[model samples]
Target: MTKTIVNSWNEWDPLRHVIVGRADDCHIPPAEPALDAKVPEDSDMRGQWGRRPQDTIDRANELLDGFAALLEGRGIRVDRPTPIDHAQPATTPDFHTDSQFGCMPPRDVLLTVGSEILEATMSYRCRWFEYLNYRPLMQRYFEEDPRFRHESAPKPRLTDADYHPDYLSDKIGNAKRLEWAAAKHFVTTEEEPLFDAADVLRFGRDLVVQHGFTTNLKGIEWLRRHFPDHRVHAVNFPGDPYPIHIDATFTPLRPGLILNNPQRRLPDAQRQMFERNGWDIVDAAQPAHNSPPPLCYSSTWLSMNVLVLDPKTVCVEASEVYQMEQMDKLGMNVIPVALRDAYAFGGGLHCCTADVYREGQCEDYFP
Candidate 1:
C-alpha cells in the first residue's frame, strides 16, 4: 500500500499527521496597513516592532514542544517548521516592511486538502514571504508521497491599493468596526487575490472562508476557481471588530456539531446551510481571561480554537476551564494542553498546528 503524505478533507476527521509551529526567532512585526487593522485600538501591541523578548520566546517554545509531545503520546505524527530569519525586512517591489511575522503558527501559512498542501497568498505585507518557513517540509513531503501535489497561489503584490486607509486609524471604536463588518467592508480591497490559510475551514466537499481583514472577495473567488470541484462558501461574523482567522470564531467539532464564538456569531443568513443540514451550531464558552496575553494580535475568543483530534477527542488550552467543561458536555474528551502563555506567539492550540493527514476521505455532510 502507498503511504499518504497530505490528505485532510475537513477539520474534525481523525487526525493522524500534522505540523506544529515553533517560536524560535519570532518577532513583533512592524506596523503596516493590514497588520495594524487587525490589532485592537487599545492593544498593548500598538507601537511594538522588534524581535520578541527572549524569555517569552523560550517559554512559548517549551509549551509548543510539550504540546507536540502530548500529540505524539497519542500516536500522532507531528512535524515542525524550519524557522527563517524573521528579523530581516520583507521587501517586495510593490512595498517594503521592516520585519517579517514568525513561523510560530503553521496554520496561517499552509492549507492541506486531499493530497495537496497549498501555500496561501498572505495579505499582510510583513507576511508576504512567510511561506518560506515551511518550504523544507513541503519538499520532504513531495519527495515521500508520489501523489502529493505541492501548490502555491499567485503571490500578491500587497501594494497600498490592497488596503483601505480609513481602517488605519488608532481610534476606530468597536461600534464603528461592527458597523463596517455588517456592511462587508473590510481592510483588504479587491486589488488582487489574497488570503491567509487560517481564513478557510474545509468541510469535505465545501470550503467555508471568512471574508474579513486578511481575505477579500477576490481572494474568495480565487479559491472557488482554484478548487473547481469543491463548493466554496463565504461567511462573515459581524460581531468581530478585528476578524482575521476563522479558527478563533467558528470551529467544527464533528459532522453535525460546531462551536461558534458567541461574541462573533455567524449571521443567521449564513447559518442556513448548517441548520438545514441538521447541524447544531452552539455558542462557545466565554474565554477564561478578560484579556488576551501580552502583545497578542488575537482576541480572547481563542478559547474556541480547540484542535479536534477526532470526532470524540479535542485539545484545548489548559487555562480555559469553562471551555474544557463545555467540551466535556459536548461529548468530547478534552485534553488540556498548557499553551496560553504561548498565545502571544501566534494563537492557541488550533492556530499553531496544521493538518497533514486525517484518517478519512471527503464526504458531503451538508447535502
Candidate 2:
C-alpha cells in the first residue's frame, strides 16, 4: 500500500488528488467569545444555535456531491470524509461547547504542505474537535504513502484568557472595528498558539500567514518553528475588520498572479516581497450579490474563494458572474458551478477542498 499520494507545495499547481468535504449534519454552533466577535452586527444568524435546517442540509449535500462528481469527471481523484455525529458537544477540561461545527470545509482545519498534513490549532471553541472528521482519511494516507507525515499541532486550551473582553459586546460597529484592526487588536490574544489552516498560505519555501482574529502572532510563530526550512512572514490587512481566513481575502491563482479583495488590500510593506519577486496582485472583482447567503459566516467576498484546477483553469461559484468574467479575462478557463445554497454549510468551492497531490516540486518563488 505504500505508493506516492500526499504531496503539495503551493496553491495554483495542477491538482491531481484532493479531499472534498460533505454538508451532512452541519450545525450552527452556539455563540462563544471568538465566534460572536466574527458575526456581523446585523447578521440574521445572531442568537441562532442548533442543527441547521434539514432542507438546507439536503440542498447543500446535493451541491457538494455534484461538485465531487464534476471533479472526478475531469480525472482528479476525489475523496470524501466520513461524517461524524456533529450534534455531539465538544467538551474538554479547559472548555465546553453546546455543539460542534461541521466538517464541510476541510480547508479550514487541514494544512497540506508537501507530504505533511498538519491539523491547525483552531481558535473557535466549537471547532476544536473538527479534525476528527478527517482522521480516517489521514490514516489511509499514512498507510498508503510512506512519506505522508500526518501531524497535529498542540491543542490549545481555549480558556477565557484567550479572548479579549472588549469584543464580547454585540455593538462594535465597523468604524471601531476598523480602528482596532489597524492597531492589530484582535479578539484572540497571545495566550497560546491558535490558527485556522485557511489562514496560512503556502508558497515555495515560504509561508504567508494572516494575523487576525483566528490566527494570532503566536500561531504564526509556532508555524515558523514547526517548519524551520521555510521562511514565515506574518501579514496584517487593516481594512478587514473580521479577518479570519485568508482564502477569501488573498488568493493565488498561479505562480505569477494573485487576486486580492479590494476591501482588504495587502499593506504595502507586505507587498514588497511579491512586487520584488515579479508577482502581480490584482484586485478581485466585487461579488455579484449584495449580501452573503442566509446563516453563512463568510462575507460577500467568498466570490474570490475559487478552486484552481490548474494554472489555466478555475472553478467559480455559478452566480459569481463578475468573478467568472474576471477569471476569463485573466486567461483562466472558467468553470461555473452552482454553490450559493451550500455556502451556509461552510464556504465556497476552494474552502471545501484540501489538496492531496499536485504535479510539481517546491521552488522558491520569493527568492
Candidate 3:
C-alpha cells in the first residue's frame, strides 16, 4: 500500500543539504587529458550544461555552509558534514553524482533499490569526502595507464531532432550539445561499470539497496520486498518517459501542497489520487503552445527543478527565482539557493540535490 502524507504537508517533511556549490572533483569525471584540453575554457557549460567550475564548486561548498547557518538561524537542525559517495559508477558522467541524488535515504532508517538522493539520508561512508581525494588519484592513475580508451565518442544530436529547431534554440547549440551528451551519457558506460558498484557499497549496503530490473513489475516487486513497511508508489507510467523521477512530475510544497505539471504527467486518475488524499495540488502546467513544460524540452532549470526545504518551502536555483516567487505568492515559501555551476548537468536545485527520507514514509519504487 502506498503511504500517503495527505492533509498537513508539515507532518512528513525531511531535512536537506545543498551541495557547497563548488565543483569538487566529484562533479567532474576524472580528467581525460584529451577531453580536458578540448573542453571549452571558462565556458558557461555549467550554466548552459549544468556543470560548475572547480572554483565555483568550492564556492558552492562554502555557500552551503552559510546556507546551513541560515537554516540554523531559522531553528531547523542542520546535519553535519555528511558526504555522498562519489566513486559510484554512474550510467553516465552525470551519474557520477548519483550519490548526490541517491544518498538521502537512511534518515528513515532503510534503503531501497533505485530511490534517488532526493528521498533519503545516506550512510556516512557514502558521503563525498570519504572518496573525494581518490578521484584525482584515479584520474592521474588512468592517465598513466594507456589501456583505457573511449570506444567511440557519441555522434552529436541531429539538428532537426531537437525539441526546438528555430534560430533561437539553435543559437545555443553548445548547451543542446551538452544535453545531447547527457542523454547518451545516460545510455553508455565508461571503461568499467564496477565503478558504480563500488560507489554504492561505499555508502553501506543497508543504505544502498540494489535490485534487478528484468522487468518493471519485477523491479517494483524487488523494491517492495525490501521496503514493505513504507508506502510504495510508482511515479513513472508508461507514457511519461521524460521526467524520470517523481521530483520531475510532482514537487511537494509543504505536505499536501505541490507544484505539478498537470498536462504532461498527471491524468485524471493520478490527479484524483491527490484530491482524494486531500492534497492541495498546485497545477503548473504550461500556457498553451507559447511555452511547453520544461521536461519536454529537457530544460528543467526554470521552474521545473527545485529543492524542497520542508513541506511548505523550497530552495531553488537563482535562475528560476521569478517562477518560484510566483509559487511563493500562491502560499508556498520558496527559498532560492544558488546552483550556477550545477545547472550544467541540465538540472537545478531539485536536479542537483536528492531527498533521501521523509518523516512518515517508506521508499518509493522505480523500475
Q: What TM-score would every model get versus the actual structure?
A: 0.98, 0.99, 0.48
lDDT of 1 at 277: 97
Q: After superposition, how far is residue 310 of candidate 2 from its true place, in Å?
A: 0.8
Clashing residue pairs in candidate 2 are none
lDDT for each residue of candidate 3 in 1-367, tens digit (9 for 90 to 100): 2221111112125553222222243343333211122223333332222223456456555655565576657654443323344445333322232333222212212111222221121111123223332233224424543432211112112122211222122233445444543332211112211111111210111222121100122333444354444333333322232222344445555534656665434446645656675767666634212332221223342355555565566665555655666666866676766554433333344444322223433322111
> Cα deviation in Å at residue 163, candidate 1?
0.4
Question: Mind sharing the TM-score for model 2?
Answer: 0.99
Highest lDDT: give the candidate number: 2
Tens-place lDDT per residue, model 1, 1-367, is 2454788999999999999999999999989999999888999999988999999999999999999999999999998999989999999788989999889799998999899899999998888888999999899888889899999999999888999999989898989999999899999999999999999999999999999999998999999999998999999999988989999999999999999998889989999999999999999998999999898988889999999999999999999999999999999999999999899988999999999999899899888
Instruction: State the C-alpha lDDT per candidate.
Output: 0.93, 0.93, 0.35
Compute the lDDT for candidate 1.
0.93
Clashes of 2: 0
Model 3 accuracy (lDDT, Cα) = 0.35
- All candidates: CA RMSD (Å): 1.3, 1.1, 13.3
lDDT of 1 at 152: 99
